[model samples]
Target: MYQKNPNLYLKNQVMSASPNKLIEMLLEGGIKNIRLGILALEKEQLVKASEYLLKAQDIVSELRYSINTEIDSEIPQQLIQLYDFMYSQLVIGNIDQDIKVLQEVQKLLTELLETWKEISVAG
Candidate 1:
């Protein structure tokens, strides 16, 4: 969808993203991909779904480690809670519901990115 409907990814909005903000955006993008993968699985496209989900897992894994090293994160403490919830739901969610969650996650990351941009601009 991203390649086909670049608009769905909001390319212009993402292009304006700063470097640090970009990382969070990538994490959100990963979540979105994971949900899409689940949708693919529901549609019985196992190979495609696995591919997307693997990509998503790889992205989150990278970001999770990067956060540990790069930032003094009180956020991780919170993210652990969210991660647990997301994991639990991952096991339980149908494809449609997972996609909904992914969309929400994307919106949240976009907000975080914008907040960081605001701080940088202010400073």
Candidate 2:
């Protein structure tokens, strides 16, 4: 069996990706993890849910911190706050094992992904 290293593949993709692509990747990752976390919470798998949610928190935190504040506008601050809320929700939902909280995060991430898709198409 020939197995490819997913980490190496992902690293190459990231190294070659444009800024927009990177953001899309992060959003997609966050959404995927949130979806997994939701399923884990629904099944009462607190440990697995916590693990997935923590990964989501990390991705969201990265997205939040990676925002370009140099672009003069209120958008950066707004995005920071949104990401902050999502990050906190991940924590709260993990501790409480709340499926709804995870679902909310999933919805937000999906919306972000949709916007990025549109941007990519228009750009």
Candidate 3:
């Protein structure tokens, strides 16, 4: 029986992903982290919550940086603003242990992920 290394498998997948697919993966990762953070917060595990929320924030930051403003200035600018808002909410939710804020961010990420999936499939 042969088992592939999980890390190597992930690296290969990432290497082969199209830009849109990469963005979709990032969105899914961010959403997963946010959900974990919320669960950790509910469990009164502040450290775990902080860690998960920070990962989600980092993903949002990556998405913001990946946007090409020169290609379409207005839309990219708007997306950057939305990402900034999500990052800010993640920080505040982690600090205050605010489940409501975390839920709001989760909703936004879900909507974005849905739209990204649609675009990826259509294009």
Highest TM-score: which candidate? 3
Give the per-residue lDDT of model 3 (tens digit) for 1-123. 115578787788899999988998999999999999999988999899999999999999999999998884588889999999999998898889999999999999999999998887888
Weakest 10 consecutive residues of candidate 3 by summed lDDT: 1-10
Give the residue spans of candidate 1 off by over 4 A: 1-17, 68-73, 76-123
As for candidate 1, its clashing pairs are none
Which tens-of-lDDT digit does each residue in 9-108 have in candidate 1? 7887678877676675775677577667767877988678767766665665555555543457777766555545544444333344455655455455
Better of 1 and 2 by TM-score: 2
Question: Number of backbone collisions per candidate, in order?
Answer: 0, 0, 0
* Model 1 worst lDDT window (10 residues): 88-97
Q: 85 in model 1: Cα distance from truth in Å?
A: 7.4
Candidate 3 global Cα RMSD: 1.7
Candidate 2's C-alpha lDDT?
0.91
Which residue runs does candidate 2 get wrong by more than 4 Å? none
User: After aligning candidate 3 to the native by TM-score, how far in Å is the CA of 69 from where it should be?
Assistant: 0.4
Give per-residue lDDT, candidate 1, residue 26.
71
Model 2 lDDT, residue 76, Cα: 92
TM-score of 1: 0.49
